[model samples]
Target chain A: MQKNKLIAGVSAGGLALLSSPAFAQSIDETVNHLFASATGWFVNFIFSPFPGTSFPWIVAWLVVAATVFTFYFTFIQFRAFKHSISLVKGDYSDPNDAGEVSHFQALATALSGTVGLGNIAGVAVAVGIGGPGATFWMILAGLMGMASKFTECTLGVKYRNEYADGTVSGGPMYYLTKGFAERGLPGGRFLAILFSIFCILGALGGGNMFQANQAHQQISGILGDFPGWITGVVFALVVFAVIVGGLKSIAKVTEKVVPFMGVMYVGAAIIILLVNADQIGWAFGQIFAGAFTGLGVAGGMVGALIQGFKRAAFSNEAGVGSAAIAHSAVRTKEPITEGFVSLLEPFIDTVVICTMTALVIIITGQLSIDPATGNYLTEGGRIVTVTGASGVGLTSAAFESAFSWFPYVLAIAVILFAFSTMISWSYYGLKAWTYLFGEGKTTEVVFKVIFCIFVVIGAAANLGPVIDFSDAAIFAMAVVNITGLYCLMPIVKRELTSYLARLESGEIKKFK
Target chain B: MATKYIVACDGSSASGRAIKVAVEQAKLNGASLLLVHVLEWSPYSFLTPEELEERHKRRNEELKRAQLALVDPLVESLSSEGVESSAIIRYGHVSETIADIAEKEGAAQIFVGRTGQSTLTKLIFGSVAASLAQIAPVPCTIVP
Candidate 1:
């Protein structure tokens, strides 16, 4: 045992040394690559012979898409926020409901999936890279994201299928295929297949690996020199135990864990803000000025705006169809009821948690650039670079600066957030995988095992390129999912009208 | 000999009522009470086996603390009333394990709290409670 321990320690140390240098070198190369790619994309978009531009131009396209979607939906997310709360309270619970889990449980489960590291680390990254001004744009993007979530979740419910054994299955794939089939669109099947493929890839990378990587980092950071494989092996085992039992197990675990973690993390942030009371005003000032003037460490106003918008988009994921899969499992006949509940996602994730993280970072004055390299510096003397994503290390520094001995707390929170995210994303990816690869138990196990393997890779390898690739995959999913939503908006409108009519007739109130 | 009833209770107020309702039904049917609580594993799935077990043990202890706080009082009250009852705690999923325990213990009735929907509606559309009711191969009463 002693010899094994020595060997293990040496191997881990050697691996870390080898990987760290490679990671550092690759980060520089990746940053240069991103700049070149962005430059090329921008030039092509501006000077192309065609009137149109590239798909993801300046990250403003995401904001504009959200804006257009919000207006087109007539601000459904804002108007229906309270109604969503009531839906979760089971004010509209009916046995005749066609879906599976309770609206509250579904919302909790879905929230568990979305409200992970994005809120903590992602927000920190945004503020670190974009400065205080990024916070303003994140809030703006979050507000608009509410509408996008509303549209997709409603459609997810409307097109769901119930099996003979009374299990409900639905998501973007169902809506994309069935909604289009209803409209006699020729390529509905093809688009659905494409969306499912992206969802599977996304689930494995963004959902699974991203989550495990953060959790592993936190554990290793706090506990000191634990083997990386320990995290992967243990994570896979625990995840396997739950997921193998299927959605019911996942739901039960999520319902309990998500609420507790959400309250705890948010409570901690609120306490930090209260402790740092004096700096709040100055933080707000910096945020506003940096937002407009683009005078922060990120170079210009456009760069700051892009970082904020990108982070918010990453954080809330309003356009991505992943959350809709979880929401679709809700037990409700009224699709709009679930949609109302879905709006709370952005409110809780971006509007509340992300905002708190931004405040904690900004108020702590950690958003300032280092005089040496123009990069943001944490209190711990580490130069905070904005290679791709900015959430984890920055948030940890902010919490540490405030609480002093609170790195453990932030680390624990990161583990819980990331772990919950991976488990929930497993469901999303599995659903997407099952949709495409056939829903055999064997196939699921294969996907899950592969997914678990990536957890180690994500933790051990440089995430700069991998996370970017995964983020792009998720964004690609959004592009496909939102297009499907656009095509199926009429169905959502009809479902909303029908549910509203039922509400007017006192049919829903009878349950109360 | 009267058949036993297994009552699965979380610490929620509704679950407290479920225990009360199960006790009353057991008394009426001349059945014994087997109170059970299931504690779920935490989301820190990335911990080692020893760590996972350690976490589970910690959670089990917490659950035991809650059970003692809630169930001990009820057990004492029932003994004072000259009623015989027992409590069992398991660490697993609520629905499937509840059904499994009911079957193993030869429970004639299964009682659970209706946290999400009312018993009547959940009966028709089915829920965790309804799923238990359908598959437990025994009568189930969901207490709201």
Candidate 2:
């Protein structure tokens, strides 16, 4: 009887395995179809172009808000640039202050969140599509983004709630609700709720899923083609450990290691540039020429500008109000100091780092620009990706051309970047979750489990419409955040003026 | 004017000897003893935003616990022995902070327990006694 049972179990297992492939394929198709249809309306509405134009209204919304803040603050990004450096260096920090974080710690954590795929893959996408000129617009947008970061972060700290248990919470949600009410403005609560909802969606899609998706792609590129679900399950388990198990040491280790990888990445870029030293001037020339003439890039200069601003906004996230959540945790009596520290984020992320990625791609001949036509080589009316690979893969190809061993390094960096991003976004999403549902152990755990599950789904499925919807959700945050920022600008100006006046009078003591 | 002496405590047997020597010296010289316990910390160490958020609260808790467990009882025992004493707790590089307190307090001399760190540790991260001997503004005494 036992021998008969064993034989029967083995036969059943074999039979199920033989049939499972077709069943699995059908399931995958059904899920993909459902996601595409469900998310189509949101993606269309958010990314819909302006009247008779291809420019996305969401991109325009972010750019306009950044530009307005730059003017409203009297170019505070430039004016307080020196002060921002001082604050980050801890020269003005009071060790006895009630806050938890130093300016540098806050900036570094926020940078880890914003600096991931956007700097690596997103820049590749921009330059690949918009030509070399997108670099120029990207740098410009990054600079203007400083002011927007400064305003939102200042408001974040000013409106943060401190509890008797020695814990605190702050972000765009706090500012929108409390700040609006303080100014006697109606609809602050509604706006806050809307912002929180979008923030959660953005966190799931772009932060968790997109990160897992890209990481799996990079790993499979190296380790040989296997199912994405395998990668997804592994990533999900590790992420679950860090976020749910409270494995803070692992999180801290990643935080330290990610910055080191960032440095190595930049160093490699510098070496590649130096290796092709003679082409440095020509690369800049291409950037400048492409910015205006579009270098035969489709949709001309306007296309370049749109891609540049969109990628930079996506990369630095200056106006999205996410950085405000990170910066609000800083320990300081003066809220304006965090704002100063935050402006450096865009400058470093987009102007410095993203520019490096663009130059490497342009200089290494990955773009394959045709000198005769003054246009990048194209197939089927669209600029072709190297080896039919786009995004981080294209970036890897560019680096591989310089160093044969670089793909392995690139793969490691990509995984590290993806992991760091997921952890940071987990925190951001958790904050949004608690804001909406009210802080509770069970409620928090529910959000985390859902976030981890999405990581697996994000890795397994190729959900184009879903990813688009997620991107739109991130920008939707900018819409609600920037509106609150407009009403709250005067408040930021008041804080900045007072802080600067005190600094000039030597009233703010220098600790070092 | 009464002189002042500094004692570094680590709640070790070596530190007990150091404390006894300092108390004796304080009585003889009519000096007040400032017992200092320094917790090792590096400002350059990076932390996550969540960790950073809880840092100040954690630091305060650590300081409170150190004062109650290490510094206060020692100070009370010294006073009972008719030795004038006070206590301080701080976070930073161990030797450097103790030396800093010595300089700022205008003490004539400093006393410390020879650290019990192993040879490998001492070679890697030098013992506090060795560091204090080199950098202290006042003469440093390391009691075994």
Candidate 3:
């Protein structure tokens, strides 16, 4: 009888909270106004100076770094591609090592952090703006970005601090401060502090807000118009439960979630592509033709190249320090193995997954073209995705072309993707927060609460400012991270050279 | 001692209980304790090449951790109790590995705990308790 009463009281409490007015329309508007305007300055400075070119130069450095790393590492992305796959498979993992997760789990976790809305909404946006030719550039960027990932993740592991509790603290902060100090380079401390600050903002913006915003957009598309704050509240509670305990529990959930969702998304894209298999040859032709001629797009080759490279940079996040943190926790004695394992992150996220999304959009006849200009017709506010408007809705329309009910599934998938990414970023942000302010329960709770609040704001607000600020924050992380990568690449090359030589000589035994 | 006993442990409360019962059995019957913790793993779970590669590394780490977290303390206590004891940590199917170790060590008896796995879990993924009854080479004790 008492147990029955306890259940009844809990149900009642839940109903009340669900219907609470405080979690409705009013809160959503307030949140939107607060964040969009506050981050205006950061959006400006990062994108400053056309310098005789119309290009937004902030992304140039990242692309340049990737290109340089690719050459400097002797196209390690190509040569070590098989080795990277093997490392991720745990081919050389030493079970006697200390760490919380396996190679695959670390890769999966980092992938989850990156492989969210970008694959769906971001792809649609890129294709809409850059045209079909963008797909070629995106693939190129993903390919080169593999080297950039190798450079940073190697340092992330090589310089990680293993505490007495057997837990690890790593990323640009550790590598910059310790690695530079060892190399007799100055400014490692300043760079680490700068990277940590950007990482925290990025965790809140790109990781939390951008995900929440896109999820809300998809939810609103399916469920019809509703208060963003309500969606925010539900998302916050779920994210808080996963993230409050930090990496261990978060890793468990993301490892499973990322792989399943990734396969599902890729599988769905493949199935859709197969259904339109007759158009397969024509689609590749359009991509290649569009690459050189730009067909009839306004900006021609330059526009497509910029958009493709930009989206690819955003998608894989090669030089960003966040994945380094996630990868550092894998149970492996050799730091270089984790580096090899991490480069696969971009190849999977962009080259494989994003390409599938692109093919589906093109093959399904969702992207409408302008006959006169030979460019994709843009009306309404959305361009990148199928139908009008960019984001998950556009991706949904492409899938809806194949299966009518897929929009609902896509909505749920988007939410799951967004949720997983948010939690992973929460860890990234939390680590940065802890690094800045010494570790303690009080500091953790404070950061977590702030992060949860942002989820709701992200859902309620206009996508433009939230995405703008997040893109800027994410790129800011790249700026600081790549700077550190530049100083540390020689060491990474030495480690790679030694590991590969030893591997070839049979000194580094493969356990399996 | 003429007799040897095998105890399957996982550092849980129930596993601690299994250890306690095994210690008493060792004291009463003049048997030695061989505490074992098996991290149940199957190569089939690693369907992809990536998972296969990490299998050995994962196995080594699991064994090392199990030895440190489960076997070491249990062995120390048993020895301090005037009961001769040793430990083994391994990665494989828990029931099969436990039984294999028991057979190889020539243990006269085996002990294990009723773990947190529910009735449905045991139904689908057969419990260590049920498997022991069918495959164990010696008499088995399921400590509650």
- Quantify all predictions' global Cα lDDT against the true fold: 0.70, 0.85, 0.79
| Candidate 1 backbone collisions, by pair | A121-A391, A122-A391, A125-A390, A132-A287, A235-B45
- On lDDT, the candidate that comes out on top is 2
* Candidate 1 residue-wise lDDT, A333-358, digit = tens: 56788888888988888889899988
lDDT, candidate 2, A1-512, per-residue tens: 53354345434534654788544433334444555666678878888999899988988898899999999999999999998998888788764441246688888889999888889988988888788899999999999999999999999999988776677788999999999999999999999999999899889888888788788879989999676666877999999999899988788788889999999999999999999999999999999999998887788898888889988988898889899988887768899999999999999999999999999988887876677986877665346755666778889899999999998998999898989989888888999999999999999999999898778767766735545766887888898999999999999999988998999899998987
Name the better of 1 and 3 by DockQ: 3
Interface RMSD of each: 13.2, 2.8, 8.7
| DockQ-derived CAPRI band for the predicted complex in model 1 | incorrect
Q: List the DockQ of the predictions in order.
A: 0.04, 0.51, 0.08
What would the DockQ be for model 1?
0.04
What value does the lDDT take at residue A330 in candidate 3? 57
Please give the C-alpha DockQ score of model 3.
0.08
For every model in order, the fraction of real contacts preserved is 0.00, 0.44, 0.00
Top candidate by TM-score = 2
**Fnat value of model 3:** 0.00
- Give TM-scores for every candidate, taking all chains together and pairing residue i with residue i: 0.69, 0.94, 0.82
> How many angstroms is residue A130 displaced in model 1 relative to the true structure, after the best TM-score fit?
1.0
Candidate 1 structure lDDT: 0.70
Model 2 Cα lDDT, one tens digit per residue, B17-112: 999898888888899998888887766566776776677778778888998888888988888899988988877788888988898899999999
